[model samples]
Target: MSQYKPENPATEEEEPDTLLMQLRRKEGSWLDWAQACQTLLQRQKMTPQVIFEATGFEPIHQNQIVVGSQVYEGMAKAGASPAVLEYFGRKGSDILYELRILSPKDRVQVAELILNRNLNADDAHEIARAVKNYAQLRERPEGFGDHPGDAVAYQAWKTAQQTSDLQERTRAIGRAFQYVHSDGARQQIERLLSTVAASSSGGSQRKILPKLSVFRLEEDLPRLLPVVGSLPLSTAAWEQQITPEPEGPYHLIHSQGQQTWVALPAWSVIQSARDPVAIPIENRLLGTLLNQQIPPEEAQDPVLLVVDRAVRQWQSEGFFLIDRAGSLEVEWREDSGSVSLFGRVLMAVRPPRILDEVVAQDPWQLDE
Candidate 1:
């Protein structure tokens, strides 16, 4: 029997294994792969560490089903993962696959299935081959990122990966940071970290957030937003390119598809800390607080929000929970208008009230 898997009509791709086949075809055909992955991970009761390992620590591109941390997205749009960036000193995923053309209706139907949680890895190969047969029966399907050339494939993958990293980390850091530190950041983070259990309900929207048994912080974190919308736990990392003088010493960080290299007017060093890791979270808040306390001109430097385990992943790159001593902060910039600040003071000064439901498998135990 041929272990080779058939192509998925939606993804317009074929592979030897059903998972890889569906995974290959799923590029550009799916609506939100990251959300889908989160849904599946939750059902499996996989922990955050599991997700971190299976998929590199970052948001799975909504349109791509990433395999091996390398992108097999649409034909001309193939890219690389950030994991490769850190090692290669390149900030993007390189496209290892070529682009292929896909029919419109077929693309929509296929992508929807993945986004809708209508297919699983086990049935993906059969489903894909069947879909291709159906699409071919109705009309011929065109391949987008496919070619017989291996060199072309390698270059395409490498280029795509590099391009994705540059585009994401270079552009989207501020927005993502502002997102993760908002009032409901913790809840939103916990939502995706929830246990990956199969849902008893139907409907696509119901499948998004995962169910978590528990999500604990290293310590108490501040809550700064009012109505925190749901947040996905996205990750990224980047090198710091600081500009001297007027622009002052700004740090460049990359994560996801975005990078944040905002200039800091002045920065403080915690006492005489040798390592960046030793720079305490509270030290980062000195600038914000001094601006409030002492005279304006005499105020100390603005501190960069630095978390111990995440300076590379969270701070510099752009996605992670952030809190300096008393308040949480995420940097957001606008093409027009002033920057928008999203975050809240810690719960110590004021308590936060939230409404959450706990599912009881044994209802009788509660009554007894």
Candidate 2:
């Protein structure tokens, strides 16, 4: 067999040993070192452990440099200023690593923020997380613009608004003050601070409800419906027939013969539900998509999908429970064409696993 050679063999001047030596001596900027490490791993086929043995660099440090370098390249490509590039070229590997979670445009914006504010790694982490979370919101709250500072301030402001605790609200207000960029955003925080101050004086305090309420499977009881298979009810049956009970909020539905209870919260859409029902997830493909939202072990267990019969119109990309031929199934609005919407899916509820039953199945743990 002919001798195997690398597709792009390195010249004597650009050999693997030369790269290793440069890394060992710390001969160039941190960016250059990062690139050299990447070249060794990808082109030279050297493992991080082998490189660590050759040079004093640890594996974790290697990972940081490689990833941070990519983030730096993204910043540069996004037209980051020369000062910003120069500042990061020599140091701030940890800060850059935290920025890898951001998009290219966001990376440049945040890098400039870091440079301008003289922020540390921890601050960089907070800024990146805030920006990412803001980006994922379906609609931005009024008065908060799209700037990096605005994103941070918005998060702080939101926290302040939602929290009823005195200390937590104070901390959130402080953070909002620190990050508020625009005058409008500043005014918003000021109003929130004023509320806190007024509340301290024993004025009529506005109570903010907690955003999430925890419901226990064994403790709480709601309306119950025993269901079989994935189809809960036909579109006509829900729209023409189902009505709320006079006793209380009608929400929970049980899967017949299975330890599952599908519950719907008193959301505005759900409260308006004429007759909502719980459908057990039996389709494999549908179950796979829904599995992304739940724990992996629960993938095989039945997922109770709460359907709101009140919502029949296609508003967005929400998953709708529809009637396909005689069979009821879950389908995304984007993929389906002109089908009658049985109900829009309010949420998917996965029942908590019975760990005691699992422990009983282990033969080694059985008592004599």
- TM-score per prediction, in order, is 0.14, 0.57
Model 2 over residues 77-189: C-alpha lDDT tens digits? 78999999889977998999999999999999999999999999999999999999999999978788889999999999998888898999999999998988888888888
Q: lDDT at 333 for candidate 2?
A: 49
| Model 2: lDDT to the true structure | 0.75
Candidate 2 off by > 4 Å:
1-13, 210-212, 215-368
| Model 1: ten consecutive residues of lowest lDDT | 91-100
**Candidate 1: misplaced stretches above 4 Å?**
1-72, 75-108, 138-368
Which residue pairs overlap in candidate 2's backbone?
none
Which of the numbered candidates is closest to the native, going by highest TM-score?
A: 2
Per-residue CA lDDT of model 1 for 84-173, tens digit only, reads 222222212222111112333333333334334433444334334444443444332222112112112222322222332434422333
Relative to the true structure, how large is the alpha-carbon lDDT of every model?
0.29, 0.75
Give the best candidate by lDDT. Answer: 2
Clashes per candidate, residues 3 or more apart or on different chains: 60, 0
